[model samples]
Target: MTTCNYAAPPFDHPQADVILRSADRVEFRVFKLFLSLASPFFETLFGLPQAPDGATDQETKDGLAVIVMSEDSKTLDSFFRFCYPSTLADDPSLENLTDGLSLLAAARKYSLDLIEKKVCQALANPKVLEMEPIRYFAIARNARLAHETITAARYTLRQPLIPAQFSEIELITASELLVLLTYHKNCSIAVQPLTKNLKWLTDHYGGCDACIWLFGPYYKGSCGCGQVADNRFSPWGIHPVTWWATYMQEISELLMDRPSGDTVRTAADRTIQQVRSMGCSVCSSTVKENMTEFSNLLALKVDEAVSMIQLEMDF
Candidate 1:
């Protein structure tokens, strides 16, 4: 119920022939040509024959035709600002997502696809995804932005504790909420295997001195981290009991750390951080490669899971 007492400055085009009046009666002078060229709806509307009834028609100071709009003054101002030659907002990066939603509504009303896309681009910036995924996700879903929807979904997985109800719940259907909750559960389950096994690292870990020294004592094989000629031999040695135990604890903590990225990427990042801090160059390189490969597989699993679910919004 907040009303603006201050009038917004009109985005005046000196040669404009059309006046747009907002619901609050603020007037903006703009070029009919600009509107016509930007939107086919406007073009067709302006092309129609008009009555010469001056009593029913509202005229501006310079005798331009006035079109009253249902949108509020602020929305009309923002909408026209985007249509004009000037920049759309004082700081688009700092603008609220709700403001962008308003602009989208106005642009849609006029069938300004280009302006609608621009508003979507502005709203999908990195700052918005990081700062407000819930709101962004709600808008993105409704807008039919598939990539943005997925990005926002991934960002939500970064939270250790997600809410069942939030500010924009009215905009999100029960099915979408279920998809998000399932996505989180799937991501957590996706990386759970990392805690039990890490022998895959030895496949790519060359016989570096540090690797041999570190892994020799714990190798499931007795060849001192050497090439076992047997075809059945796994080049990668299994994680020792103690290392696996620590890894179990570490991976568990990282999953609860509200780690960002998909399950695979999150696991890979956390594992690399843990491996590098151990001060073992061999361990770091080995685990890095192994975790990356594992993450790829996990990514595939997520895709497979996603294919079975419906998260798309028709409109």
Candidate 2:
């Protein structure tokens, strides 16, 4: 039998009843009562009768039964910290998705529901979710976490369709990837209407004397500002300037690549410049404020559209 070796602080308490030996050989001296309270798996484990063949003898260390855990020291340490009441003040930090998933796996394995809940909350942290949403989606989907999978998949829409490669990519299957891709495609389809249809804006431009020509041929309201001769169909079928067409086209293409409100919000720099530079004098002066308002509206609508799209999770 291998001799017991090391014990880290907090896990090295002298009054503890059991020694949980991590696969990496670090021993944690903890109370069986805490383990029993935290995990049904451990509770049933401790309630079992010892083997008559003296098999338990080889696992003993310093008069305490040594429970060898499959998890390594790092995972064991984090897992135990959640189980122990004393460590509740400083909860484990799941700074990254990988570490969060690892701790979650151990918590789930031991049937620690409360610990699993905590790990899930950490996984949903905005920093953690936005770090590498594709990787998070793959890992969460593989683990069959429905909420995490959907949340991560939605976050991925903020990124380009060709996701950055990561180690966790191997965790998901082709079918799962197809689901995400399909969801992305559906979101693009949903958002394209925002660019094509102008009815959603209603009559916001109704009273605007400077940009009335943008409604694409149905403008009887007023157009003191001369229409750019190129007069193309604007929202509400009024013929606006060519720049408006170009602006919407660019926004459409951008949303096709990344269908998210954040994309719409950050994507209008060049287009805004075009609108200002290409519009008539009156339109140019007010374009900045108007465009800002419009872009904000577009972002809100984009988010609303994307929210309606649900990622299908089979696992």
The most accurate candidate by TM-score is 2
Q: Write the per-residue lDDT of candidate 2 for residues 1-315, one digit (tens) a residue.
A: 665566666778888888999888888898888889989999999898876655545467678888888988888888887888864325677788767778988988999888887777677788877778898787678767788788898999989987877888888888889889999999999998887776566555554464443542334533244444432234444456555666677778889989998787666656567656665555566567766777788888998998998887665
TM-scores of the candidates in the order shown:
0.62, 0.75
lDDT of 1 by residue, 1-315 (tens): 433233345456566687777788766777777678778888998898876676555554566787878888778776666666555334234267877878788888888877777777778887787777777888777666777787777777666547645566777788887777776666666544443343443433444333443333444343222222222222344333233234335545666434333544666677668667765545545667655664665455444443444444444
* Candidate 1 C-alpha RMSD relative to the actual structure: 7.4
CA shift at 96, candidate 2, in angstroms?
0.5
Error of 2 at 47 (Å): 2.7
What is the lDDT of every predicted structure here?
Answer: 0.61, 0.76
Tell how far residue 27 is off in model 1, in angstroms: 3.2
- Residue 161 of model 2, lDDT score: 84
Query: What does the lDDT come to for candidate 2?
Result: 0.76
